[model samples]
Target: MGINKERSAWEKVNMARAQERPSAKQYIDRIFDNFMEFHGDRNFGDDPAIIGGIAQLDGRSVTVIAQQKGENTKDNIFRNFGCPHPEGYRKALRLMLQAEKFGRPVICFVDTQGAYCGIGAEERGQGEAIARNLVTMMNLKTPIISVVIGQGGSGGALALAVADEVWMLENSVYSILSPEGFASILWKDASRAQEAADIMKLTAEDLLSLKVIDRVIMEPNGGAHKNIDAMATILKDRFISTLEKLCSLEEDKLLMKRYEKFRKIGYYKE
Candidate 1:
């Protein structure tokens, strides 16, 4: 409960990346039932980093997509530390379009360092994959709700984050880039990541104040890692309520509003 005081953006970033914090897999397990995972990008092999499939949330059918982070060193290597590759984005898009065909709402949980930047990834069209998703999701017929459950960074996260409603966990951080990356690029010193975090305004509270996110889901004291069950419960309720609201809107109206929601972002007046 000591988090009674406001936390700095850097502190929030650290908390979001804490080893004990709940990851997308844990949340999905608790919040959804009977998840059937689908693999492969159809064009390439499967990627463990970005997982997508069909699931039931509170008796309603939905398509769930999430970036999975590992809990241990071995698992991290297997999941690529949740940095998705081009194939991962392609797989997600395939599943999302499938969901749209069946009128199923899409739920995406974002927790990634960014798209994989390895030479292999670029060779496979990482940027093109993400850009394609951004374009397709803008007009998807069904509703979408993106939740930043942890460290949401760069275009990798944005590729799956276009939605009618975007939400962030209290301690999660979403930004154009990770603090270390920003520090290295701007100051030529990655060790000054703390300073970059402060300047980035990446915390959930900051984004909420800036109107970049629709809502901030409260995490248990000390962060979501402290109480996985409670955190999942809150997220489940929010998902149900939001899906219910979105289900009532006509397809055209939903798409129009989603367009407006994004178009209005970053607009400011002095």
Candidate 2:
């Protein structure tokens, strides 16, 4: 509530990085039922960073895709610190296209510092993969919703975030680049990350005020990890209600609205 409001952008970034902050997997486990996780990109190897599958939201079929982070060091290494590769994005797109064919809603949970930037990832067409998703998801027929549950950075996060409506957790951040990266590039000093975070306006409250996000799912006093059940409940309620409205729209209207939603972003002049 007011806790999120009182925090500076840098404070929100720290909260987002907290080891206790609930991961996408935790939310999926709590909010959905009968989740059947699928594997592989069918082009390259499977990625543990991106998880996708068919699931039931309430009693309705839906596609759940999320960028997963580990709670500890060992798991983080296994999960690539939540930085997905080209194959991960490809795998997610495969599931999303399937969801469209089946007329199922798609729910995306975005939580990554950014996409993997290693040489191997680039050689695998990471930019192309992310670009493909952005274009395809923009026109996807099914109702789509994306939630920034933690760090939503760069094109990696945007690939899954072209939805009818995008939301964010109270302490999560959405930005073109991580604050440290932004500082390093702009000020030649990564230590100015705190100032860069403020300038980037990556915090949920900032994004909401800028109309970059439709809603901010308020966290409990201690934060989301401290009360994951409560956070899941809040998120589930929103998913159900929003999907109901989105699903009721005619196919053409749904696509049109989704198009307009994004087209209207960045309309302001300095």
Candidate 3:
């Protein structure tokens, strides 16, 4: 009968407004010039959850994939708050493949709670779709870079994150599973989610220390939402620098580094 603090925190952070928050799309529009959007997976219906397009970052051509959360009730239903269904990931895969075919570098903005787990999504093979994206991304020929702008949970996040260099905002989270889900499975009580979150090591700082992420992009003092323009500028600079470094590498060397990067993710010795 009392208030649930964990649920409150989860909702407060997760349900924060797309308009109020400094979103990835806003940054892309303001910072990147000559942007052009592409649509649909071609095999299925178009998904508003994932937005992919071509953009010029400091005058260099690049492909951008962003997980878009909606601004209002109707748009929320459309974008699904950045939670991609199977088709959405497929759409992303199509764009990534396009970028590779054209030898264009890819930039991904990740901001998803997880892949859509609805009955419809399952029927459409959401898990298979995510797995396929991971496999294809691992072997992608063109340079790939990812930025975790907000919630990057489970396979939804992983699909876009198989990049040569990964960056995470200071306050963003990346995890294999949500804390509530983890607590439900591990402790048999969802009320212990806070404890699970502490154990999961989902924070950007923790991942950076573990080498799960290549770098941490600092947000404004209050948060990214407070100073959107400043945050966008910082990200723009980092993206330019990272892409330049990746572009300098030969395909074979870049692929080798990417392979090694993922290989070291869970490596430990006692």
Task: Estimate every model's Cα lDDT from 0 to 1.
Answer: 0.91, 0.92, 0.83
A best-first ranking of the candidates according to their lDDT comes to 2, 1, 3
Query: Candidate 3: where are CA atoms >4 Å away?
Result: 1-19, 265-270
lDDT per residue as tens, model 3, 1-270: 212223333433353323566667788897788888888888878888999899889889899998888766788788987799999999999999999999899999998889889999999899999999999999999999999888888889999999999988877788988888999999899998877877787777778888999888877766678888889999989988888988988898788888888998442212
Between candidates 1 and 3, name the one with more favorable TM-score. 1
Candidate 1 scores a C-alpha RMSD against the true structure in Å of 2.9
Residue 19's lDDT in candidate 3:
56
| lDDT score, candidate 1, position 261 | 82
Count steric clashes of candidate 2: 0
lDDT of 2 at 120: 99
Cα lDDT for residue 248, candidate 2: 90
TM-scores of all models? 0.96, 0.96, 0.90
Best by lDDT: 2
Report lDDT (Cα) of residue 182, candidate 1.
Answer: 95
Better of 2 and 3 by lDDT: 2
**lDDT measured at residue 137 in model 3 versus the true structure, 0 to 100:** 91
**lDDT tens digits, residue span 1-270, model 1:** 322247887888888898788889999999999999999999988999999899999899999999999988898899999999999999999999999999999999999989999999999999999999999999999999999999999899999899999999999999999999899999999999999999998988788888888899998877889899999999999999999989998888888888888998432222
Q: Assess candidate 1 and give its TM-score to the true structure.
A: 0.96
Which one wins by TM-score: 1 or 2? 2
